[model samples]
Target chain A: MALVELVPNFSEGRRQDVIDKILAAMKEASTAKIIDSRADPDHNRLVVTIVGEPEETFKAGFAGIKTAAELIDMDEHQGEHPRVGATDVVPFVPVTGITIEECTELAKRLAKKVSDELGIPTYLYEAAATRPDRENLANIRKGQYEGLKEAIKTDPDRKPDFGPSELPKAGATVIGAREFLIAYNIYLNTDDVEIAKTIGRNIRHKNGGFAYCKSMGFATKPYVQVSMNLTNYKETPMAMVVETVRNEARRYGVAITETEVYGMIPVDALLDAAEYYLQLNGKWNRSQIIEKKLTEME
Target chain B: MALVELVPNFSEGRRQDVIDKILAAMKEASTAKIIDSRADPDHNRLVVTIVGEPEETFKAGFAGIKTAAELIDMDEHQGEHPRVGATDVVPFVPVTGITIEECTELAKRLAKKVSDELGIPTYLYEAAATRPDRENLANIRKGQYEGLKEAIKTDPDRKPDFGPSELPKAGATVIGAREFLIAYNIYLNTDDVEIAKTIGRNIRHKNGGFAYCKSMGFATKPYVQVSMNLTNYKETPMAMVVETVRNEARRYGVAITETEVYGMIPVDALLDAAEYYLQLNGKWNRSQIIEKKLTEME
Candidate 1:
């Protein structure tokens, strides 16, 4: 069976009734399974992680997006995280027996459906981008909801890849296809934020570090951390990131307290690190693993 | 569906026709999938690894065993590897949605079918053993095919667990249930067999090493290796074994050239090592992995 993953970010997080209703709409599809659903009240956003057949995942995502649009009003929406619409970002990730191109096609198909059926403007970003500028989600959502609404009227460049050159009350939605992103954070023993910031800048791709790594420094209450979004773990790997961060932080006399994986991670990301660390040569395919073989039987 | 794995060792391997007939029987059972099948001419043995629903696996295994028994004659069998019968050892492994107890039950059922219908005397070992002494497979087939025929008649303690005391012309079949075992080997750069033997003794549980590890020294052509059978990877881990061997080999000015995983391994084994080496903290559940989530969707 072909499996694809959908991670849809919703505007509502604090209200249980609204979240439950949106989740119910996804559950109503029946074919897809909700692998994980988390709401950060601080971020004031809900991230729903769903996995199933491509068609089933699309149906479930669409239903959830429609339900979110009905329940949320972007005009009154306030969150620490940036957003454009009730369904902020809907990304299609190829999981198993599926390719990135297939996910891109699914993303485009879903984006068109959202624009035509739901009367909401959608912009294709990442692998599904129609324009080079739309390749990065941050660039596409540069103005957010309020700024994009005004910019759409005056600037031709602000026009979305899908739908009319205007934003609805629930605002605009961004749809795209991308590899699975691993949100990894390594905490330092000291509260010196500068140490983390320096390490983050040195280890991130934009600042001359690992090619596929994007990093930033953040203070989460007690500790300073190097928060990273590994865009392509196969190229850079999670272990290399952690090791480099550890080695860099040591220069500032900062010891690693612990590391946290914020969301879902790909198995290959972990397995690649294992192969390197163990120095295991010869044949060591994931399929050879017992647990993986058992999963195949299932 | 609950999944169980069966690894059956057959006495004949030189003839491709015999191997093909056995595999054909397993292929005939639609529900069971033959994950791997290897024929070692030096051992004159064929090892077929299959996984599927317990009932389907048993049906397939029974058909394969019957085909093997009919074609192979113990009087004509000669091999480099140890053996006592055509279908020497049939071990049932609990894969997914299946417990060890359930595998034990399946082993007994297979043993009964083999003895009743095929006229092959069966001895249960490991988790399916009726007597405590018969739990170890090596102890059951101690004398191999040549000595077993006379030994089974004279020795009361060496009697078959299921069937008549006398060994059939096809020889006695040893059937049991055991945890998945990973056959791993680490080759040293140096041709010093003594160095490999010393490192093997230091890491194996029987010789006061890791609890779940069994080690031995072997020379394969140009390389001398520390061959190990990890009975429980969760307890001992593959990475720890490699590290310990590497550290020990370093004392003798020997470096590990490479490592080999002989057969199917569990995904958890690799993941465990990755987590340890990477120092990834917090709840590291397999459910949080995208590839695992994809498999769950199926």
Candidate 2:
């Protein structure tokens, strides 16, 4: 089975009832498994993680988006997190036996469906972006819902890939296909946030570090964390990044306290590291994993 | 879905047509997957590995055993490996969402069917052993086919678990449930076989080593190998065994050349080592692997 992961971010997170309604609608529409759902009251945004076959996951994502659009009014919605729609962004991540190009096709087809059926403007971002300028999600969501409302009408550059030039009460959704994003946070022994920030800066792609890594520093009560998002684990694996952080931290006389894998990660990501440490010198694949073989049988 | 892995050893490795017929019979009988099959000419035995649901796997195992009994004449069978039947042994390994007790029940049920339907005697071993003496396979298989044939008529202890006192031409089968076995071999850089034998003795269960490990020394052309069967990976993990061997080899002024995982191994065996090296100290489990979650969804 070709597994695809859909993470749809909705703007209404404060109202639990509204998020529950949308979740219920998604459950009704598709056979996809909703693995995780986090509603941050501060951001007022609900991020739902669904994974299944491409068709089912796309349908589930659409159902969630439709429900969010019906219940969440973009004009009244307010959150700390930036958003341009009730269904802010839906990115299809290739999990297993899937390609980014195939996911991009699913994203584009869903974007057209949402535009035609619900009369919602949709912007393509990341791998499915029609225009290179709109590739980054932040670029497409540069202006907030209110700002985009005015800009969509006057600014030709701000026009969406689908739907009317004018924005609707639901606002515009940015849908695309992208690689699996691993939200990993490595905690340092020291309480110094500066050390974390320095390591993050030294390892992030933007700062000429690993190509697929985007890192930042965060301070908790006990320790500092070098929080990272590995956009493409194939290009720059999790272990490599962890090793780099460990090496960098050693210079600051700090050690890695512990590492946290924030959400569900692909089996291959961990298997790669496992094979490396074991120095396995045989033909090994995911099929070797009994559970993985069960999925194939299904 | 609960997974049960059945490895059926048939005493007909010299004949390709016989093993093929047995494999074909299994395919026709159940939906279980034949993950691997090895025919050892020296042993004159065919070890077929099938993994699936308990019911399906049991059915497949019976079909293979039945086919082997019909095709193979055990009286004429000669092999380097010890055996007492055409279908020498059928062990059910609990892979996921299953227990050893459940597998034992399945083993007993299948043993009864084989005895009653096919007229072949069945002896339970390992976790499914009826008596304390039947716990180890070697204990029951001590007399081999010819000796067991003569003993069954007179010796009360040699009586079959599920068949008549008179031994059939096919002989008796040992069926039971057990943990996943990892056939791991680590080669020492030294040419001396004594060092390998010494290391193997230090790591084997009988010699006060790892409780679940069964190790022996083998001379393979240039280097000596510490060939081991890790009967229970959960009790004696792969990494710990490797580390022990590494330490032992260092004591003899030798180093590890390479290691070989001879056959199919469980995912947890590798994941345990990966987590140990990575120091992943958050909420981490096998379900976090995307493929594992897919199995749960099924």
Candidate 3:
């Protein structure tokens, strides 16, 4: 069976009650399984990870979004992370036996369902975007919640892809279909933030690096990090990004202390690296892996 | 959940009715999923692969063996592959969240169940063997079906690990637990079988090669092959084996044209090679892989 992964980011992360309600709604779609869910109080974001059949995932995502919209009031929400609605962003990632185009179709169907049923304004980003500007989440959410609400009234370009022109009290929702984004962070041995920044600049696309890489520098306690969002792992692999960062960091006399996978990552990224390193000739199929065989048994 | 894979070899392979009965028995377990099942008329053997929760796998294996015993008579069975019973050899392999020792325990338990219920004599080989002599399946089944039954009367060393003193008309069964053996074959561009044998000898453990590698040379239609059974991939990785074969084959002016994973291989084996090739520093966790995330969702 084909598997689709849904990562729904809700606005309220501080309140356990709000998070529980949204999770319960997702669980109502029994066919879908909750892989991981985290409520970061600092970010004030409740990110719920789920995977299942495409239909079940769609039902679960809609149920979770509906619950979040009812419980979270955007006017009262406050967090370090940017948001435009109660259900801030919902992304459908094609996991197995599915294509990106198919996921885009599902995203559109779900967006239409949310607009018609919940009266929530929705803007499709990434692969599901109707407009070129809407192709990026950063572009779609250029203005924060309050700013977006005002821009919708004043700016013709600010109108959402779905729902009314005016944003509701709960605010607008951003939904899309995108490849799995691996939030990878490579920590440097040195505490010098400048080194991290330099490495990030050298490897990130914005600074003339890999096409599918987006990067930034951040400091956390004893270490400085080159935080990266692998936009398309197939186009530019996680290993390549890490190696580039390593090479750039070496020029600054800094070594990689460790790396962190912030969230979920796809298996293909690892398989691609394996094929390259092993120099395994011909076509390599994942089904030959014993773990894959075991999963199929399940 | 812990996964245990059962790959059972049966004496009969030419008859579809016999293969169907064996597969049906495996399906009867419900939880055990048949990953791969093939009947080789040339080899005159049926190899069935199934994986599931340890308990479910045990149940399915027992069911399949019982069905094979009922349908196959060793006295009338003939196979090119070495065998001594209807259910020739059953090897329990640990895949995920399980240890080889745990699989060995499962193999012992399953062996007892078969002997006690079906009155089939069973010999434990590999990790589950009580004696060093019975550690190898080839050593245990040296005499094959016709010879082993006669040898059991006089040869004190040929005694069965379980069941009655003599082998039944269906023959004795070999059951054990072992580390997952990845049967990898690298086909060379040149059809010189001697070059393949020389390379195989240079990389195989028996001839001062990799510690966990066992290799032989064989010819298959269009190419000469360096057929290998990686006993412990963790110790000597698949990539290392491939590289060693490649380097050795170059002495005879032969290039490794392609490689084939004969059956099932653990994802770790491939991932290790990827890490080496990619030079990916820090958090290179299998859990970060996308396919693994999907499986966990399941």
Candidate 4:
């Protein structure tokens, strides 16, 4: 069976009871394994990472979005992070034996179902975008919940790919497909946040650094950190990024204390790092990894 | 399912039909994946790698050994490698969620079945060895087929562990349990075979080097190679070995060209290498690896 990773963002984060209900509903609805569940009180959002076959993953996302729409009122929603609906954004990532093209199709179907049944408008972003303008998530979420409320009815440019121009209290949800993202963070020796910021700006794609990289520096107490999101690890590997950061840190006379893989990372990403560090070549066959061979047999 | 890896070595490798028959009988008898099957005509031996749960893997090994005993006459077998039986040695390695102690139990059961049903004397080696002297396979296979035939009837120390002290056409089989062995090789920039040999000796356990490592140097045409078998990678990781070899090559002013992973390897071995090379700390969770998470759910 093909494996797909679905990350669904919901508006309710602070309320443990509400979050539990939504998670439980989704778990009961599908056979997918919810590998990660992070509820940030500041962002006022809950991000759930689920892995399973395409059909079950789609079901889990739908169930989660449906539960969130019922519990959360977008009209009263407030958060540190920008969002558009009760179930703000759901991105489907290709995990094993699945392609981006296939994930895009799955995203389109989820968008249609949400719009049809929940009456919550959906905007397709990234690989599933109909127009080039909507490919970037920020472009689709330009106005947030308040601005999009009026813009959806008046502005043709703000019209979603699915559902009516008007939205319910739940608001519009951004649905799409993207490559596996590696959340990597490099900690600096000193507590100077500005130094970390300078290094992050130099190594991130937004600042004309590595492509498919989004990074920002944070004062994470004991050490200043350059937190990064590698949107496409296959094209822009973790090793190249870490080495570049190492070089950048050396310029400021500040050494990196350590690096952190913030969440569930694909095994290939780390294997890439090992290959680069060990200077291993063609003789090493990735298929020879026992677990991978067992997966093939399965 | 508790996964076990079984590597069975047979006496006949020159005859394709004989090797195919032995392999076919094993596959037909059990539902195990025959991942690697290599027949070396020079050694006149066939080594087959099978992966499956305990019971099925036991069935597969037994079937292959039984077929090999029927087809291969040990008295007529001659090769570069040492051997005492048509089915020389069968080693059961714990792959996933299984301990060496548990694998020792499995190996003993298989040895009993082989000795009882086939009447071919068996001696347990490695982790399953009854005596400390038999812990090393080289000690058990000291005299090969010719010497073992007479020693079995004469010497008390040469008595079989499982069956009668009488010799059969198949001779004796060494059955045992051992940790997953990683077949690793590193090639150097220069074709000087002695440089590779020195490096190999400096890093191998047999020559007073690293623990759980067996290594040698070979003149592998384009470049001299340092070949190794890492018996217990959990204790002595791949990163430590690779880095040591890299440092050793530096002394001789020779650079490492590349390294080869000769056969199937456990995922944990590479992950340990990645963690070391990447300088990744606590934030990374091995359980978070998507494929591993899927396997855990299963």
What's the TM-score of each model vs. the native?
0.80, 0.85, 0.87, 0.85
Alpha carbon lDDT of residue B186, candidate 3? 87
Q: What is the lDDT of residue B163 in candidate 4?
A: 92
| Residue-level lDDT tens digits of model 2 in A196-272 | 99999999999999999999999865989999999999889988988899999999899998888887899778877
**lDDT digits (tens) for residues B140-253 of candidate 2:** 898899999889889999887998776677889999999998888888887899999999999999999999999998887578999999999888988899889999999988
Per-residue lDDT over A1-298 for candidate 1, one digit per residue giving the tens place of the 0 to 100 score = 5678899999988999999999999989758888889998988899998988899999998998889888899899888998889999999987666788999999999999998988889999998999999998888778788888898778988887778888888788999898878888889998888888898899988889999889988876588989988887767888788888889988888888888887787676788888887767565566677656655666
Model 4 agreement with the true structure over A113-146: per-residue lDDT tens digits? 9999988899999999999999988888887999
Clashing pairs in 1: A288-B265, A289-B265, A290-B265, A290-B266, A291-B266
Model 1 per-residue lDDT tens digits across residues B21-47: 999988896477888889999999999
Candidate 3: global Cα-lDDT?
0.84
Q: What is the CAPRI rating of model 2's predicted complex?
A: medium
- Scoring only the second chain, what is candidate 3's TM-score? 0.84
Consecutive 10-residue window with the lowest summed lDDT within model 4 chain A = A277-286
Q: Give per-residue CA lDDT, model 3, range B1-298, as digits (tens).
A: 5777889988888999989988998888658788888899988999988888899889888988899999998888876888999999999988777888998899999889899999998999999999999998899999798888889878989988888768887788899998888888888888778888888888888899999899989977588988889988878888778877878887778887778887677777787777665545555666766556655555
Q: In lDDT terms, how accurate is model 2?
A: 0.89
Please give the fraction of native interface contacts (Cα pairs under 8 Å between A and B) kept by each candidate.
Answer: 0.80, 0.61, 0.68, 0.81
